[model samples]
Target: MEILNEQVPAPADVGNALIGIRGGSELDLDLRLEAVHEGILVSGTATAQIAGECGRCLDSIEYDYEADIQELFYYEESEEFEDDDDVDQYWVIGDLIDIDPVLRSAVVTALPFQPVCREDCLGLCNECGINLNEDPEHHHEILDPRWAALAQLSDNVAEDAATNKTSDKREEK
Candidate 1:
């Protein structure tokens, strides 16, 4: 992860090439540097597995993901972008370029929103307050009136159907 030595005058010729970076699941980085006309082009892929709570069931979930990132560090400094508020961020110092920031950016951007253990995970039961995944046979007590608007609607529909049937028979005769 140290590139201070590689970043020197051309005569230094230390390590301006590919380097492997291994860190926490924060990310595993593989980086390559190319001295282009503009500046050093850092290209690499970051991969890692993360553990998080499921959005629906609150269960622990683990996911492995990878993000490919490329960053351009222009050597020229101008008034177009200011570095006071962190707007100007470049890896070009004198000759040494760092890819940590680029890999971190890619890993952060690749993270998922609202992690989920499984797409079909059945969340806790609203009535019994139980994890549905853990106990499939769990049931909650039906205390309140579970049948009101729906029951009335069904009864009214049945009566109307009976009346329509009777009318139909009379008309047929």
Candidate 2:
């Protein structure tokens, strides 16, 4: 079977994850089904337009994604494979096979756990919550509270030493 730019509802979000395909996206399907001794082998490729936020920068991202689908739908009444409990197969009802589960599995597995807009994305600034990619030079100087007293003492000591040195040089001159 061949499908051209068919609109299909995407699977639900995966546990509040950042990367996901937008719902009601266009999917192109090209599949071939073959009847085998054990079951029907389904092989196909599904292509769809995915939209999500970048995991690093949280910027909107859009891309075309393709997932390969390959699974077997076993006959429910077949007794030849009843003894084997380790076989993974989907149940076939009458002459129809549920393809939604297969499609969902394929698409989700193909997606990356952390999708980025680009490999070299600079991400956002933790202190200011600004996009570092847009302003690479943005920065903030935050001193550690534990060392604040030591930092002030060190500055005072440096100033005292400078003053002493100047006075001694003048006396020597």
Candidate 3:
């Protein structure tokens, strides 16, 4: 079955990586179902529009995504399975197969773990929380806490040396 431009609700956000699928996004599905001795094999491709913020700069981003769906929906009473509870298989229900789980898994795995707006995106500044991409020359003059005492001592020594030099020149005059 070929579904074109079918409006489907977007998937939920994926942790800090992916925000979520765009609302009112159209998903094009091209799927084929085949009945085997063990179960029905579902294979297809699903394409949709996904929108989220960039993981680095928090900029809004939208893009087209495609996922390949392929799974087996096993019959409930098929003799091919042993009486083990550890097997991972989908069971068919009364001539209807719920493809939501398969679709969700495929799309989520296909998405990038860390989505970026561009290849060379500069992340936010740690000190001021500013986007570094916009202002690459931004900086702060604050010294590291570990070296703060040493820095203060150096400044004081420099001042004392300058004062001594001026006193000696005055005495010479």
Candidate 4:
């Protein structure tokens, strides 16, 4: 058994479209490595800086995320998983265990499916791309299409009535 505490650079593409850890950023790793009959067990936590845009408001979202990492890397000559073709296995190569894939898996899975800047983000207006958070009461007064024709007809009728009333008053004078 061994304890490993170190800071390593984050691997590329450790996130989804909405959020991710930038490559070369610092990742603080605090883990334990154990040797067993099958292979080596690596369990720890990786802390990384997450940055991306919010899905709802498109605001920049930045935070620190700690992902739990636990994976088993089998020896190259080990036959423990030979029969399990469907099982994804990690192997020790040249006595070295590459934890990039493992770390990526841990971090990516923890990323939010739809990241948000805040819990109650109002988001942008669908009609005119305005941030509703800034103006909660902002809205466009859109007349219903069905009522628009009726409104136009009413205006025409009112204009004709006014014209007839003026002509009648002139003839009376």
TM-score of each model, in listed order: 0.55, 0.79, 0.81, 0.86
lDDT of 1 at 98: 62
Off by over 4 Å in 3: 1-7, 11-17, 81-87
Candidate 1 lDDT tens digits, 27-119: 455566676666667766656555557666777666666668677676665333344765636758776666656655665555556555777
Screening candidate 3 with a backbone cut-off below 3 angstroms (N, C-alpha, C), the clashing residue pairs are none
User: In candidate 1, which residue ranges exceed 4 Å CA deviation?
Assistant: 1-26, 76-89, 137-173
**Against the true structure, whose TM-score is highest?**
4
> Is 3 or 4 the stronger prediction by TM-score?
4
User: Cα-based RMSD of the predictions, in order?
Assistant: 12.4, 3.7, 2.9, 2.4
Q: Would you give me the overall lDDT of model 4?
A: 0.91
User: lDDT score, residue 133, model 1?
Assistant: 86
Local accuracy of candidate 3 as per-residue lDDT tens digits, 1-173 = 42334546555542235655564567677778888888888887877777888989999888877788888888988877656787556879989888777777777777778898998999899899999999999988988899999999999999999999999999999
Residue 70, candidate 3: Cα error in Å is 1.3
Ranking by TM-score: 4, 3, 2, 1
**Candidate 3: worst 10 consecutive residues by lDDT?**
1-10
lDDT of 4 by residue, 1-173 (tens): 99999999988888888899988999999999999888999998989999999998899999999889889999988888656877668988887999988888888888899999999999998889999999999899888899999989999999999999999999999
Please give the CA lDDT of all the candidate structures.
0.59, 0.78, 0.78, 0.91
TM-score, candidate number 3: 0.81
- Global lDDT for candidate 2? 0.78
Q: For model 4, what is the error of residue 3's alpha carbon versus the real structure, in angstroms, after optimal superposition?
A: 1.4
Best by lDDT: 4
- Order of candidate numbers by lDDT, starting with the best: 4, 2, 3, 1
lDDT of 3: 0.78
**What local lDDT does model 1 show for residue 63?**
63
